[model samples]
Target: MNQKQEIQEGLWDEEAAQTYDSNEGVFAPEVLRLTVDRLAALAGPGKALEFAIGTGRIGIPLAQRGVPVSGIEFSRPMVARLREKVDEARIPVVVGDMSEATAGEEGSYALVYLVFNTISNLLTQAEQVACFRNAARHLKPGGRFVIELWVPELRQLAPGLQAVAYQTTDEYFGIDRFDVVSQHVTSYHFHFGAGKEARLFRSPHRYIWPAELDLMAQLAGLELESRHSDWDGGEFTADSSSHVTVYRLPE
Candidate 1:
């Protein structure tokens, strides 16, 4: 297997795909309502394509709202899980790396979206830039590309600290170890279940700031349209922890 395939398997194999759907907090109706509403509005009358469309989490609901949606995914296991929810005719998915893969013919989509910090999964600057270029290639002249990413929380760390605990609870613990010089971060998740059952998952990423993300988009012939703190159009501020940014290709 190639490097990309290895990464996909390491992070999203069959077991991970099965466990992914068990997160009730992430799949709640209230949480999905706003996200689907915003994406549907952005899709307008044309089709939308989702990069890394894991288990059809967002794509399925967005399609249910009357927008034509397709996806590009690297993990066959994850795609199989998605297939269990919807058929190929309703929501076709091509198995490939999003960084350089083509989901369909060029200029066929009105919107392209990457969510939940998936861009950082590329783990390299070149790959992330290529993913932006790939999105531009698949979009119509007036199409929009959207991304929802968390702002790096290095500021929360003390002067000499390299790690930050983002979540701590009775059943779960989450921490991120940061390498400031390299912009590399590894998130460590520890889950504890009943009867002494425990599990750990680690995912590495290359975190990008908003300014640098805009530069990548510019390199791909896309212009920044708007940025917000969330899907509800909250203003993006210095204190915001995450952002929803939209970029547009010239008409």
Candidate 2:
């Protein structure tokens, strides 16, 4: 990847922070348990580092399971939300961009993970590659780097269609505006409630193909160790909407 492209950062304000935990699609117990269980198994007795560990979603639970977990997160509001559940002593976090931040000893973690499509928040291919390298830098030799991400569904976009309403429910409505040529999307989420005001959140992302992510890992000196369609190690096939992929540094 070219190293000179100007990177775009995300804005995680109070609204974004406050509503993060309300996403039942992700924050539901069963949803979180699978992720925590799988990560804990990979973590063994060693430490795990999280990139963009928003509100300690996975970090806190993983740490509680006896795997030391630290994190790098850029949003103050998000960090504040995390503090509500656990103090810094429980799941320590570094406040900076995950692509450029350090949270623990170099090459000291048994696993480094970025989940919930957080890698897409980097907004540029170069920064995404840097994030992979950062994960590698934080990993012990032969340690794992794992990520959860949605596969790009550009095929759903009809000609001249720049936007798609990917989700609509009684409580939530979500849409994504596509920049197909640029591999970027700006997602808009409108949330509803029972007799309460509607809430809106907007986030930008740069999508990457699985092959492109593999190349990034290769550049970071990490090799693809495994990939599954979900947290439970389901087979990855053409129809899967998302994937959990793990890579490893040379032992």
Candidate 3:
């Protein structure tokens, strides 16, 4: 495998891939439903290309919603799990890096979506910019490119602090350590089960600010259309934790 193929190796191993559908924190049905509704409406009768499709949590449902959906995913194990949900005919998946890969012809999809903060997986500003350009390349004129991302929440950080624990439960605890200079955050998830020792998983992400993402989109020939706090189109405010923003190619 090339270096790009190994990008998701340690994090997206078979064990983690298997747990995806069962993880309610990540795969809540209502979340997927709302996402599909919004993307389907934007897609209309045209096709969509999902970045990092990842077990089809969104792509499968979007395809089931009657919009043709294809995906570019880097993890083979995750794509294998997605294959169990839908066949290639229903949702064709290209196994490659979303930042640099294409599902088919360029300018073929009407909507290109990267949900669940997946763009952060790129791990660098340059990669994120390339991803935006790649998304724009796959869109037809006037097609939409949508992204869901968490706003950087650094207000909780005290001076000289580099890490914060944001989630705690009886069986789970989550923390993120930020590298201010690099704009990167490494998330650590700890899981405990009855009568079992704890397991920890570390996922590295490069978080981008909303304004930075807008500039990246602009560099890719896309114009910002709207920004919302959620799939329901609520207004985005300074206090909002996450956002769903849409950009469009010129007609």
Q: Could you give candidate 1's per-residue lDDT for residues 1-251 as a string of tens digits?
A: 87866876889989889999998877988878988999999899999999999999899999999999999998899999999999999999999889988987889999999998999999889999999999999999999999999999988999889999999999999999999999999999999999989999999999999999999999999999999999899999999999999999999
Candidate 1 vs. true structure, TM-score:
0.98
Clashes of 3: 0
| Model 2 spans > 4 angstroms off | 1-10, 194-197
lDDT of 2 by residue, 148-244 (tens): 9999777788998999888999988999999988999999989888898798878788998899999999999999999999999999999889999
Cα-based lDDT for every prediction: 0.94, 0.89, 0.91
Give the per-residue lDDT of model 3 (tens digit) for 95-209: 9888899899999899999999999988878889999999999999999999999998798899999999988999999999999999989999999988878999898999999
Estimate the overall C-alpha local distance difference test score of candidate 3: 0.91
TM-score against truth, every candidate = 0.98, 0.93, 0.97
Q: What order do you get sorting by TM-score, best first?
A: 1, 3, 2
For all the candidates, what are their Cα RMSDs to the real structure? 0.9, 3.1, 1.3
Residue 14 in model 3: shift from native, Å? 1.0
Measured with C-alpha atoms, the lDDT of residue 232 in candidate 3 is 88
Worst 10 residues of 1 by lDDT: 1-10
